[model samples]
Target: MNENASSDVKAKRQILIGLSGGLSALADRMRSQHAIATKITTLAARAEAIAQRSWDLNKLNSQDLQRTMDGFVGEIKTFAKQAIDAAVRAGSEALLGKEVAEAIAAHSAEIARLTREIDSLPDAAAVRAILQPLSVTLNTLPARLKANTAMLKDVDAIGALATGLAERGDALAAGGTAGNRVAVELSRDLRQFAEEATTFSLKMASEAALAVKAISDMAQRTLGLSQGNPVSDQAPSATDRLMTLARTGPQAGQVWATSVSRTSRSSPVQGTPPGVKW
Candidate 1:
């Protein structure tokens, strides 16, 4: 191949390698996000179970239950936001630039909008309406992350192919003209791959943010925490309350689980109508 053609192929090869590296990094991010999603899902389930048990045993009134749900939701919202911010920051530092900043702003706007909707949830039923859908969405997160990771891998493979083709000029063509055409096609493929990555990241972040925001907003409203106001003595923020509850919730969940297991194995123990027998 001519000197100019060889230089062009080398440049395209570099681009392909860079693209593949970005995809690999994104796949790693998705793996980490998948773990976060799994934890959120488990947290939602535990909170819901605790709410149900409290309600059934009349340990909390409807309003109180709503408040508790709000607190948990607040905690989740903070968690989700932190996760997104961290992921975006990490991506920006590693594989991204302005692309992630735009996406983060968009997701933040959506979360704010959902917060208004969550504020309208006045009762336990309303709280459940928001929480249930979020729980369901979070339940699907593992699958979504798996698919995204697979997609990144597939794109990375394509980049590798393009890089290989660029490096081995004779593999695609015997002459300068053929080599030029291969370079043009490889450049086009790189552009398309970059666009796909941007789009995919935006979509993934949007879905995760929206689901968590919806539930978090609901919980904040239930707890009567004013979004516009700063946290104070009378009305602590949902995240704050959730932190307090979280300290005890794990032990409570463990006890509840043990009680449930024992009951499932044995005949129902006679108890007062309203109390659960362990």
Candidate 2:
């Protein structure tokens, strides 16, 4: 080949390498995004399941509080019934027939009214009313406190899950920037490749051009082969290249690209390496 044609071919070879690298980088970026998407999808499904089964914690619906109220109301009602009977009996012993009978009737009516009120008002206020006079420490207070603590913990767990989901969503959004970066770089590479291809075509048309290359030339160039070697005579075979990639790159938290490296696929090992895993 003439000097000019040789130089042109070398430049084209370098450009093709650049084009391959750009496309590989793009594929790597997409793979990373795919892994992230998979993780996010898994996490989202878990979050949704948890949300669907989340416990409803209403203060009024507390089992511990309800038990306490029921016990308080029962005790108070018993005490009131006893008090009314005693008052009516004492008044009967102190008064004449008509007055004593009227006192007993009035006491009975008041007792019935109190019982009806207690039965009708099934709320926290009624509980408080009965509990105030009793002045007794509730048996379920400790259990109720524990339940409240558990409820707070549930809230915190839900909040944490929500924050995680939000962060994952943000990461997915950020991947858009990565996608755009891949597009820009790939576009630049493909555009350069096209321009170089056109230049090669025009050069062939106008002048004593680069020699016509065989189909085998493309296979050789794609693997970066030259003079019966790739990179050097000591280069690993394709399978060895894959094995080396599996061995070396995975150790350092490398992700995205798992294929053998385009350059430096393996260092030339001299001795027979022990049974290598494919």
Candidate 3:
């Protein structure tokens, strides 16, 4: 009985040792599995963080791209506005130029018409008629004065003779005969003076005619010059027209510069990126 009991105790001791060994092995396996699970969890967390960072980076990149696109769009709009304004300005200038040219042309036509009317006046013909007779009379005046002087000299000689006779008569007491001789000499002198006065009148008339002719010539010449029909051969040239256009047209540089400045100021600025400095 004692032997059987000792044997049973030994068997129980062996069985306990085997169970402890099995438990220790099972604990080691559990520890290894726990370590693997911890590693896996850490790796998963890291991957999630990396993915989040990537998303953030993508968002930032997209925002930056949007901002850049907005800037580009703004610039494009500015260019378009400039182009449109330039076109409008050009059109306006063209219209202004045309209006100015038309106005100039109208004024020129009016001037030409007035000139023609003035030239067509009957003043020249009337002036010619007035001058021609006056010129003839002036040409004959000197001859008439010479003839009149000769007649006056004759009258003076007759008067001297008559005076001498009268003195002789007075000495002889013949008063009636002396008075008759003096009367005849006075009458001759009056006739000569009258002829000379008539000659002078003719000369005056001729001078008046010459004056009329001169005035007519001057008027015609002035009209011709005003109409650009210079007595000289020189005519207005293409350069003159160009100068006129320049004086009337808008300045090129000023128009362009103004348009550019206006377009720049009126254009919108680009949108800024989120959390980024302009």
Candidate 4:
């Protein structure tokens, strides 16, 4: 009878061991599923945000729009790369689990899609075309101002000439031949005054042109940065994700295992008699 009882106990232990193993496997599968789901959700959210930003940028003019669009494109690319790295790391953590690999592959596809979309956007040529007129106008402003200054200088000279002629005529009328010399001197002074006035007008025009040129240069630079070549290459790499997963997965697994062990230990054993007679 004792031998039979011993055999029964051994069989029960074997069953328990098999059940525990199965439960552990199930838990791991569930965890992997959760990780994948989380990753997918994250990627979707990122994509949505990127799309929205793109739409917003579309509303702006070429000069105003490209900066915002470029920023969004860069961010999307960066997020996608980061996601890929995370997936790779997660896969490594789960011992190269299928779910992790699937997630990573999905992210990679998304990144590629974003890249293509960004590349397909209108090139700087179109932007330049739009801005070229403005640039030309700006470039011409200084010359226009300078011409205006020259015209003003001529006006000043005319005014000065008029004043000197009037003075000389008055002196000649009052003192006749004796005032003649004085009149001639006054005439020379008037001519000098007219020339000074012309110079002043030209100076004003030059100053205005300079101011306009400065503003134009600033606007052009801003536009160039927005639509310029060689967009930033700040996306995350696959290796980065793998390393993160390596660091976090073991810790996560340990926490899960500990919780399971505790819960299992705490639970009352099955098949125990409710009321046993000793």
All candidates: TM-score? 0.24, 0.22, 0.19, 0.27
RMSD of 1: 31.6
Clashes of each: 1, 0, 4, 4
Candidate order by TM-score, decreasing, is: 4, 1, 2, 3
Candidate 2 backbone collisions, by pair: none
Comparing 1 and 3 by TM-score, which wins? 1
lDDT of 1 by residue, 67-172 (tens): 5544443443443344333333322222111222222222232233334553343343443443443333333323332332333333233233323323433322
lDDT of 2 by residue, 1-278 (tens): 67865654455344334433432332232233233323333433433332222111112234543444444334323432332232222222111111111111222222223233432444434423433321211122112212122222222232232333333323323333343333233333323323322322222121111111111122243335212133322323445434433432123342212121121112111111111010
RMSD of each: 31.6, 46.8, 65.5, 39.0
Per-residue alpha-carbon lDDT of model 3 for 12-108, expressed as tens digits? 3333233233323322322332333233233324323432332332334445634543443343234324323322221221111222232222223
lDDT ranking, high to low: 4, 1, 3, 2
Error of 1 at 41 (Å): 26
Candidate 4 lDDT score at position 171: 52
Poorest 10 consecutive residues by lDDT, candidate 2: 206-215
TM-score of 1: 0.24
Tens digit per residue, CA lDDT, model 4, 1-278: 47855554444333323323332333343354345435534543444454344345435565554345345434534653554343333222222122222222223322233233333334434333433433343333223222222222333233333333444445534543354355345434433433432333233223223322323233233322333323232333566544434432223322111111111011111111111010
Which regions of candidate 3 deviate over 4 angstroms?
A: 1-4, 59-278
